[model samples]
Target chain A: MNKKTPKSYENMLEVKNLKTYFLTDAGIVKAVDGISFSLRQGETLGIVGESGCGKSVTNLSIMRLIPSPPGKIVDGQIIFEGTDILALPENELRNIRGNKISMVFQDPMTSLNPFLRISTQMIETIRIHQDISKKEALAKSIEMLKLVGIPAAEERIFNYPHQFSGGMRQRVMIAMALSCEAKILIADEPTTALDVTIQAQILELIQKLSKKLNTSVILITHDLGVVAGMCENVCVMYAGKIVEKAKTDDLYKQPAHPYTFGLIQSVPRLDKAKDGKLFSIEGQPPNVIDLPPCCPFHPRCHKVMDICRNQYPPTVDLGNSHEVSCWLYAEHKELADA
Target chain B: MTKYIIRRLLGIIPTLLIIITLSFFIVRVAPGGPFDTEKKLPEVVMRNIEAKYHLDEPLVVQYGRYMFDVLRGDLGPSFRYKDHDVNFYIFQSLPNSMILGVIAISISIIFGISSGMLAAVKQNTWVDYLSMALAVVGISVPLFVIAPVLQYVFAMQLGWLPTSGWFTNGDGWQTILLPAVTLAFADFATIARLTRSSMLDTLRSDYIRTAKAKGMRSSSIIFKHAMKGSMLPIVSYLGPAFAGIITGSVVVEQVFRIPGLGKFFVQSSFNRDYTLIVGVVIVYSVILVIMNFIVDVVYSLLDPRITYK
Candidate 1:
């Protein structure tokens, strides 16, 4: 724990004021408003929010994976290892996507090609970004399957996606993602579609593998518990903005923003004995197209003020690497007393 | 799997019976007899001809006798052509139509699928628009219209090749080219349009996005991922289309002066060659049935989730 501080930070990725918008027939949707963050080597960052909060959109913008016409990363600078990835040619970006930065999608069943065998899909992925003989590719693929904890890798490799259960398909997706030993992994709700037990096993596998490889991870999810368990740094998003960010322990202990506070309170804690009462955030998220002029959450925010109704709050720092955007924390010293 | 197949096979029985029964009665009901054009043959000769085909008796008896002949694979002799058995004439002309149909359909499938894939991969680009536009033009303009236009431009004006015939002295491809091109035009358009639309739908699938996320080359994604996934719809359209081509279209044969099955079918109908017409209908029906079976098998192979059983 002490080794984490003052660690010589070799910056792996720096994203500055990224903005991705979708120009739909209804109107322009600011899916990801201006947001900035940086990740150093061997770090795990958890991004948590409700759906439509831009957690997934942020990662998609980084990868330049958004479909155009309907989607576009309008303004952003994604400086990955000194090069602006947003400006790179598509071919170069293709090489970096699987080799340097890999992503595992939400639904494992549909993510895999139904027509192809597990071995075929895995081996083809390995060969695409690397030059290796068929025999070597096959061997590496089997090793990867085993690496993800599938027993009898050789025999199972030939089986189709349907032959495997849902949990196993997620394992297959993870295996494909890790085949290249990628430096950065982007897992978007990786375990959301799996059963609770399988989700835990998958989470554990990811944590162990990341530690072993010293790889960085961007865990995108709505499950606060998973984020609290796995991520070191946490970012809370609301209506496309990073409303709060802090060290995991600090964020849990001192949730600065109302949304974050609400999220932590909403999780069912056995220790609380709160009975059948589940804390529900009142109202729904704001419409992206015609959002209010001030804070998007003002209508639902319990701490709404005259200023909060007309003005968006700037981020206020709360030391120990914690920051949040909410009018309640506007007074720097007064906030400390509370 | 076997149960499903047996069900599909049994399903065809009722379909074929209806087609044969309806066509036999319908042809008989039409305005003329096979000997209508001749000088009203002597009563005895006419009665003998009708008796030979069981047409001298009641409609039910004639229908029963015709069905029996069909079961025996005996199409009977032609009324107008005289002594030329309907089955033999059909077999002789069928190969010609089959060759034309095969060549045309092959070109359509290859070009249609390839171009459709390209359009899907490069969506909203000029390639997508151009290919779609070409398909639209292909569909709107009938083959008869395109055939003469193409013939005029390439053959009459360009003089790059011979105009028509299954062959000059029945040698090789020199003669079959024009007729085949004419017959294939509409099918090529339909295939291209179907392939393009189906591929576009496939490209939007979650697996395709996963493939792209897997860091695959765009070409591999288009061919291996998109093309293979969208093939079921294309395959479904193929069975009937192929049968249509093989059975032949009369307009194309007339325009190109190729004496294929289409020409025979039309001539038999015109002359009220009842035995020959009946034979042609039966042959066409069999082709349709067989093609449909092959299509079902191909569909099952492409998507394991499909089960006829």
Candidate 2:
């Protein structure tokens, strides 16, 4: 679909101040509160955060898959291929979904329809976007199954999802998502449910496929190790907001936001076995509903400042595309707790 | 699936035997005998009547003789019906009941599933409330009340349909409509309620969300992806309900004055017509067994996870 645009299109996708909220009987939950990020044409972006930090909601908002009544995208612009998808009509949005952008969910055990054969699911996904014959769709489905390294793609394609193992099912999902050659693939914790060994293989397969197809990937996971290995750009989110953003190497080498530093410190390394006790960030993440207008991490940060309690710190640019949000990086703030 | 069906068929023999044996003994245990009347007959004449039918013999001998006759497809003669045998009467009325039941079930299924699905899809809307409200009314009102109200409205007031009886007047299907609808209304309500909850559960499943994420049309998602999963409960219900309807509805047949199995069933029990009572029970048992067998086959078809050995 980007064929209509110039070949030199820089950013494939851009999200600006996306605020997704869930209005419950208790209160309005700011699941994703005013966050922005962008993905380059072929670059993989990582969104790493604790559970309930709106990592999934941010991507779901892009797809407009969040259940309404409870969930509403209060404000946002999800610009894909120079057009804002959030503002597009449903028919236009449908043309973008699975045609230009595809999504892979977390669990494979329950994601695929148990009654439908792998062939049926795969063929439908292929045929929906492309005006292809059923025979061509079947052949393309077989090709995709083979491409995903599924053994005996010819025979296994006709079998039901229950006949396949969990890892194999996830592979089938990836194959179906990419069958239409979607430009962007949003994988939300795709390997979180797999075994440790299988996770590496799945991630490797994703990396290899994206490189081959030139598909920009937005990987959402809580694992820093996964981001370090696959993503060129990483955004660390905390309490529904991006606390820091930078090149993967720069963020790891020179962590700026206190929350980001605390997350890095929390990762247990096998190479560093001389630790007395593993580092852990004290205190739970703040409740997102009716959250205060200040840094959410202030209660847990060791370098807590008096100003951090009153006003939210502005994002500070630290060169080479590194950005952080913390009172420690603010130049105008007085030394309230020197 | 064929193997499973064959096994289920074989399993029906012992079940039918039990039903036949129980009904045979139960009818004899009732208060009056087939020949009993308000006016007493001469002792010699009573003895001759009993002797002719083998009732003068021991109860075990009569049971053995009855079983033997049943094996040869002879249900014996009805005492109260005079010349007609139990088999003859059943053959005559069963078709009428079957025709009424088939029409009723079809109508129930079409309306029930559609209304139920609509309610689930448009939950919290007026469409949901209205359909469910009608379903509740259908269930809460007994068949006797519902049957009469329909007869009065469609037959009496509207003058568009007949009030009762079948094949007596010049009218054909118009006579069958009132009773068929009466039978269907109650069953329709049950099916609708069951389907709504089932569809709601299916809609919330992960696969449904996956279908939506795939950018499937709403119709395709509901019909193609969600339909079969929700049908499990409804299929199981239709089994027994099918057998009951086909066997006959006592109230429906009586109210409409149609000649059906249920009418004979009620009459035979009242007059101590042992042979007729046992015959009707046998038909119900066989149909129930077959219907359950059908349910199992459909379950395997709808759900791939269920397999036949």
Candidate 3:
């Protein structure tokens, strides 16, 4: 922000009131309602949410990769490295994508071009950003592939995507994303399509490589355990808004929003022996189409108050930068005034 | 790939045999022989004529004899055309038909791919609507109607071309222009519609999104990533289409007054010239089979996932 002169330079990314809407025959679906967050260098920020909660949409908005026609970013300003990405021209914006910032998608099977060799896909990504020869670009691609734990990466790079296993394809995806030493990496459920063991390996590879490259990461996933292990800070999104934000440890110790509380509770606790039944949050996520100006998680909140139904809750700051948008978190005097 | 082609070429023998046998019998099933005439010849003269052409022999023996001749690459004598064999007529017209067909297909590919890609990339816009509307007209109107209409406009009304003829002057290729364009019109429409839809589907694919996400130049994304996938349908179609066009369209040839294999195909049937009819069929079948083989090879090249084995 113009007001925070010095701190803005320190932050890697700043998303201000980002809202992405999809215009359909039924209505305007606010896939990502007004939400704000920031990421800093070498810090992994996890976006945790159930399906359709705008975790992926928010990142896609950052990348400016939302498919047009039906999809549009209604209101948003994504500031990266002191420049407004939303206002930048196409030529300028392209330099930011896959160079300054890159993303890994959810499904590895469909994410890659099947007809092309891994070398072609990787070299294309690398050569677009840097003015390198094809041979050099291919060499860099093989290096990145090897770094991501692919065996015989030099030979394998020439093979088509279909020839690779699911886990190997995801590894290639990561290698392509990190090939250029991008400042920020966005991984949208990168491990979702893989089995449990492969998922851990990919997550670990991402963590290890990004750390070595000193790349800040915005990791979007539904797995709280992944967040607990991998993220320094975490955001809990419900419907299209971030319901809570805090340091991972502190949030685990004390979840401020009922939705966050429900998410943490729902996870099977390894510390406890044979629980009778797993805890689950009641009610489905609100339909985002023409959604009301109120708390989206209100229906499922245990402490749902009258104020939550008609009015959106303001973000309440608990000490040490922990924040929650909940009527329950409001001070009695503030509640009375409203 | 070399081995596959060799095996495929060898495999054509049995297929050609079946086609030759079927045509040899089916032509006989029709009424009247090649020698039939309204005025009955004297019995002695007719028997002498029948014996000369082996028509007096049993049908099986004649078929065996014809098969023996065909094995040595001879198509036997033409019954109607004096002092000619089936091979001579076929080989003579083939180059003329091929020249016309090649020109037609070249026009179709160039116009079809560019217009179709434009329609797809600029979908729902005026460019899309205009090109698609033209394609619809092309597909709906048949060659017989289209050729004359084209001739009417370019030749009669505009006086830009000859009315109907091949090589108006000994070296005049201007005659080929009208007919080739007419021949290409329908196929252009087919290719355009196919390319438009296939490109649309491929453009929406996850890989295309990844290409965009990688910040690829729009031209590269389209040509490198989207083009090959969209071309699959068109490549598969090109085989049979080439076979049909190379032999030429009967209506296309007739309306334009051009000599092509299709003319022979129509006349040989009417004349009940059994050997000539079978020879034409053999040419069309060989071209069709060979074209399909080329398509499969191209498929493997375009999509690494495909393998002949």
Q: Which residue pairs clash within candidate 2? A: none
lDDT of 2 by residue, B93-193 (tens): 99889989999999999999999999999988999999999999989999999998998999899999989879744457688889999999988999999
Residue-level lDDT for A7 in candidate 2: 40
Query: How high is each candidate's TM-score?
Result: 0.92, 0.93, 0.94
Better of 1 and 3 by DockQ: 3
lDDT of 3 at A230: 99
Per-prediction backbone clash count = 0, 0, 0
What's the TM for chain B in candidate 3? 0.95
Off by over 4 Å in 2: A1-8, A272-277, A333-338, B26-59, B168-170
lDDT of 2 at B84: 83
Q: What share of the true interface contacts does candidate 2 keep?
A: 0.59
lDDT of 1 by residue, A1-338 (tens): 11112233377887788999999999989989988787778899999999999999899788788877699998878878777888889898898887888888888889888888888888888898889988899999999889889989999999889989889999888889989898888999999999998999998888888888878999999999999899999989999889999999999998989889999999988887557787889999998885666888898888787777877787888898799988787885544433
TM-scores of chain A across the candidates, in order, are 0.94, 0.95, 0.97
Model 2 chain B lDDT-worst window of ten = B165-174
Ten-residue stretch with the least lDDT total in model 3 chain A: A1-10
- Candidate 1: share of reference interface contacts reproduced: 0.60
Best by TM-score: 3
Per-residue lDDT tens digits for candidate 3, residues B1-309, read 788879988998899899999999999999998888989889999999889999999999999999999999999999899878999999988888999999999999889999999999999999999999999999998888888888888888999988777873353778899989999998899999999999999999989888888888778999999999999999998899999999977888788777788889989999999999999998999899899888988999999888776
